[model samples]
Target: MPLRVSRTPTIRHYVMTAPTFFSVEYAINPWMDPTTPVDTHRALDQWDALRRTYKELGHTVELVEPVAGLPDMVYAANGGVLVNGKAVVARFAHPQRAAESDAYAEWMSRHGYPPVRTEHVNEGQGDFLAAGRILLGGHGFRTDIRAHREIARAVGMPVVSLRLVDPRFYHLDTALTVLDDSTVAYYPPAFDAPSCHRLREVFPDALEVADADAHVLGLNAVSDGYHVVLPAAATGFAAQLRAAGFRPVGVDLSELLKGGGSVKCCTLEVHS
Candidate 1:
């Protein structure tokens, strides 16, 4: 039987990790201070805690094999997007992170997710935002212009390509998040004129997350109706979400952040 996702409904999320959770390239630069045993232990503890939290929260999780030697696989959000009840395998352009998608594809297959297709079109899942319509960002990441159309074709929804500028942010989700059908939290500077126009075309009343809060990837919030989960570090951001009429729940991502991921990266959601 084919498991289907309503165009809008509950999303079952999965978290994957290899043995690399304890041994990852937490820092982008090798020259940075190396990972300490304390950091590793902290990361491992947090990861295990995250798994339990998700299962407790009603989402499914699977810890898969680590990609051969890649240190970043632990922050698996970059691999793909589980949408329309299908696993759309992402083609990441980052030289170091491109291999992560392979594992995502394999896992989706093993789990009976929809067929995996390549979108050499984009590189970062940060750029892929699921909303009333799916929006993909490029100009900053490897999300090719054509990938937007491909995404539309794959899901039978409009995949709008939001313009981006380089060296600003790695993914759109890093700087922005769609809190609901209309509200958004983000760093305003991240969007170019055309991008903002595109957004205004639909959601004219989005909430703006502060730069200080968004800096910690706070804008990358995950929600299911009234419930939301974020990094403990983003307490203020969480409060802001509450102030904006949301029910906020949070968790610690100290270890996950150290590995370049946050709450959103840890879970793949099916928005209701």
Candidate 2:
């Protein structure tokens, strides 16, 4: 099936909330926490600022009620993938996150998004992306191999499964964002040879960022095919992207690091 992606207006509207509104164990696990008073302030500011940035760019903004106990819940976009105006609630691999898929489905319906069923067997939105083709990732997170295949069957688009090598960069978007189907920007070490081969076989000239850049999830990037988003601190990566033809829009997400999230993690891109 042809995946129709509407260019959601430069004024795309996204739903968001702050870490202060919900709690994640952001203190101990270096893999996921950025907990400190400084961290909290930064995270809250980033969340609100990101929403404002989207609005400034012409997208609509809706703030959802923060899920009471889960900090991961604040990174709402992972619970689902919005495709062709429909929302498919992701089946989280982590049992702790299973409840979120249903939550997203209900929220999407209330907001009038085209209804798409929820699945608990798939891991999370970290595994899915849609452009000319459907690309999904299988990382240490909640997304599974079965979920990848199911997404293809459900969405009627070809799916590419990225088996992950690092748990830190748990989502496909953390390292790969399609640049018009003909190009992509990603860090290589997080992926095995077969995975990189599949991507390169299709887009031989795809821009590749070094793994050193991927460590801080530096490769975690977002773009509307017009403006690309990454860490404001990652000036070098931003320069690389800018040089490659995408207008760069950097945001300070150092606060999200405490909760193991970032710009791409904070919002789900509901394509036009």
Candidate 3:
């Protein structure tokens, strides 16, 4: 199908952490198989390419220093959800990633975004996504359902809670991508029946990706109204994005995929 592009592109600010200490030393998600070898050098190279891609596309990219022992800190999107100058810091579900919240919160403070620490388990943007005026909160895995309300109070945005069912797509960003304020693309099976129904009702025009694309973490993407940056392997989703009036820029983060993250996993949008 011919591309049907229309929406005007918007310059966005994003936060990313270098994959300096990136390694799959332990299995936290289904995609993480520590026995599998990880090319740290390749991971760093790929992450740099992703950061460069954002800059080339006219977006501001900020860096958060990666701590020595926090290998998964490279997945910066899990750090927190930043919107309207407020930083709602994450309270990680796993002990391995808990310290990362402090590192990210420190960065936020230094950057002038006062952080609001949540009492409930919330894995930052991994479980919370801002969709238009409302915030989409995902639970049933990394984030507690109770955190949804806490986040809503922190950010002053109406929160919509969605329950995840598949462990493979543990985070909300893993199974769903907010293409624009009112549009989204997702894999319905990753969510519970009610959450799937809620998504349908809220975003009737949402693109439903095939299993092949979803498995490649295609739904994990970042969009600037018109341009959508996604995994290079998600050709099916790329085609869909073009058909739906958006430009798809593919980047290979295959090395970082060893730790179960791709483009969106590494990029955290800063709404300031």
Candidate 4:
């Protein structure tokens, strides 16, 4: 039998692109060790596997054209977060990825999505995730705290700010994943004391992932309420998801992990 996503009342759409120009040429996060070389060929193969996984589970997948010299462009989630047919483009903190803003903007414009250029620096869904009525955002690294307010105003949702403590968990999507409208999974160590407390207050029953899984970018996974797409190496977390009654489909994205990205990093939800 083919694995299927347990559909919610509303459908969700995601955008991703093949890793045609992925490489770890610069160091942005702790996960990126420039000394370690990345195999672009293997990265593409893994990315294709993930894309196929999404399609197999019954989800619409859109692609953003890959351009030369933009290695990080393959991490589509950083482009921007889409909500209500509007996209708030990311003003990247690093010069290396600054060019990606326009590339994502062109795609949105062509697709009838009006782009709202954010004033503060934010890395799209990489730092922002929409869960039900609220938006969860992260800062203390690539994204500025001020960007959270900008995102809230642009998207017209109440935004909750979670401060990331660990450099390896620089992005919110890296340390935390929204499993459903009410449930979430997170690596507690990635957040500070207060942020952890806040997460507990908001999601008291949030699933906690072990460090063994977190280290492999397991928390940086994608979920459509029922089906979860994550790194194949995160066996512990995969078993946990299955136990929670959600279908966990593992995809090997080890090559992209050289650049500090996994499944969620390459996926961007396009809300209608």
Task: Count the clashes in each prediction.
Answer: 6, 12, 0, 0
In order of appearance, the predictions have TM-scores of 0.82, 0.85, 0.98, 0.95
All models, RMSD in angstroms? 6.3, 5.0, 1.4, 3.3
On lDDT, the stronger of 2 and 3 is 3
lDDT of 1 by residue, 164-205 (tens): 653445567666776665556666677788777776776776
List candidate 3 stretches off by more than 4 Å. Answer: 1-5
Query: Which stretch of 10 consecutive residues in model 2 shows the poorest summed lDDT?
Result: 2-11
Model 4 pairs whose backbones collide: none
The deviation in Å at residue 53 for candidate 1 is 2.8
Candidate 2 lDDT for residue 218: 65
Candidate 4's TM-score: 0.95
Tens digits of lDDT, candidate 4, 188-210: 99999999999999997689999
After aligning candidate 3 to the native by TM-score, how far in Å is the CA of 116 from where it should be? 0.7
Question: What is the alpha-carbon lDDT of model 3 when measured against the actual structure?
Answer: 0.92
What overall lDDT, based on C-alpha atoms, would model 2 receive against the true structure?
A: 0.66
lDDT of each: 0.64, 0.66, 0.92, 0.88
User: Which 10 residues in a row give candidate 3 its minimum summed lDDT?
Assistant: 1-10
Off by over 4 Å in 4: 1-10
The TM-score between candidate 1 and the true structure equals 0.82
